[model samples]
Target: MDLQIIQNRIIEIRGQRVMLDFHLAELYEVETKVLKQAVRRNIERFPEDFMFELTKSELDKLRSQTVTFDWKPTTYAPFVFTEQGVAMLSSVLKSKKAIRVNVEIIRAFVQLRKLAIQNSEIIHRIDEMEKKYDKQFKEVFTALRYLIHPPEKERRRIGYKK
Candidate 1:
């Protein structure tokens, strides 16, 4: 499986990297229901940090940002799996396809981690350089830091705007 394909599916939720169950099922070539059933059967293997259901607000926030996925409000909030949770999935899902997909997914996560570390190092370097320079270059260094790690934008309200 392509690394970018898996990376695109990964999203940040609750300040942690996670993949939605539906996406995992798609990668595993299994129906979402079947995947959920298998997980339910092996609940002991997953812990809170490994996997957790999305809160209503989190689901709504995702739906508001995404247009490609028709995410209607369902009774059960979708479960999101962290990197560790995804690793555990291989044990629950005995199929060869599932195991292969799991490996690819883990690779994608590792690649993303590497990219994050690179950006952090770049940011650290900028900070060090900023301290050495006078006030004239202060703005330049600030801009560079922002470019490397942009701040989160304020989310708009869901109701109709006044």
Candidate 2:
């Protein structure tokens, strides 16, 4: 599977990087219901930290913000699996495809973590540079910060003049 496709399926929820049941099912080449049944049968393997059901509000927010073209709002809340939960799934699933998909998913998660670490290092180096430089470089650092983390929305026109 393409790493970018896997990475796109992984999302942040409640500050945790997770894959929803539907996505995992698609990757495992099983019906979502079948996957949920497997997880239910081996519920003990999943603790709160490993997996959790998305709350209605969380699901709504996710639907509103993300490309959930394949997913329609359903009465049942989706289950989200963290990295640990995904690792456990390989044992529960016990299929060659499941194992292979799990490996790819795990690699995607690892790549995301590595990127996060690299970004932090870059930010730290930028901070050190700012400290060494004077106020003259403040705008440069500000521009970098904006590039790294852009504002959610454009700022309103200040003191508007025709």
Candidate 3:
């Protein structure tokens, strides 16, 4: 279980980091349907905050943006499992592979958290420095801000004569 591979499977939905059922099933070495069935059987173990089914519109938006290999061209939307939901899955799955994969998934989530915290710290330090240097480094700070958040694309004028 490579950490990068696991991290790539994790995505943001509704402002929460989550893993899709199909990705979890692949990591757990079980069929998607079987994994979903296990979760359904132990529904009480997973609360709304722990797990939720993707809405049709959300699924459609995801499909349009990325190639979801595991999802079939069917009407059923996928279930998303949060960090807590993924940790709970090990108990429901009751398999050595499931337990091992869950550990790796948890590690990936923790790594992401650490990276986010470090990023915020860096941004805070940059802000403090900018305040200390005031107008002296205004252009430099502006460039840094642009690097942090680039502007969105602008449409070109239509039917330009010259």
Best by lDDT: 2
Off by over 4 Å in 3: 68-70, 152-162
Per-model TM-score on C-alpha atoms: 0.89, 0.92, 0.89
Whole-model Cα lDDT of every candidate shown, in order: 0.90, 0.93, 0.91
lDDT of 2 by residue, 74-109 (tens): 678999999999999999999999999999999999
What lDDT tens digits, residue by residue, belong to model 1 across residues 44-76? 999999999988898889987777664645578
Q: Give the TM-score of candidate 2.
A: 0.92
lDDT tens digits, residue span 63-99, model 3: 8667745557655688999999999999999999999
Residue 124, candidate 1: alpha-carbon lDDT: 81
RMSD after CA superposition, every candidate: 2.3, 4.9, 4.1
Off by over 4 Å in 2: 154-162
Minimum summed lDDT over a 10-residue window in model 3 is located at: 67-76
Of the candidates numbered 1 and 2, which has the greater lDDT value? 2
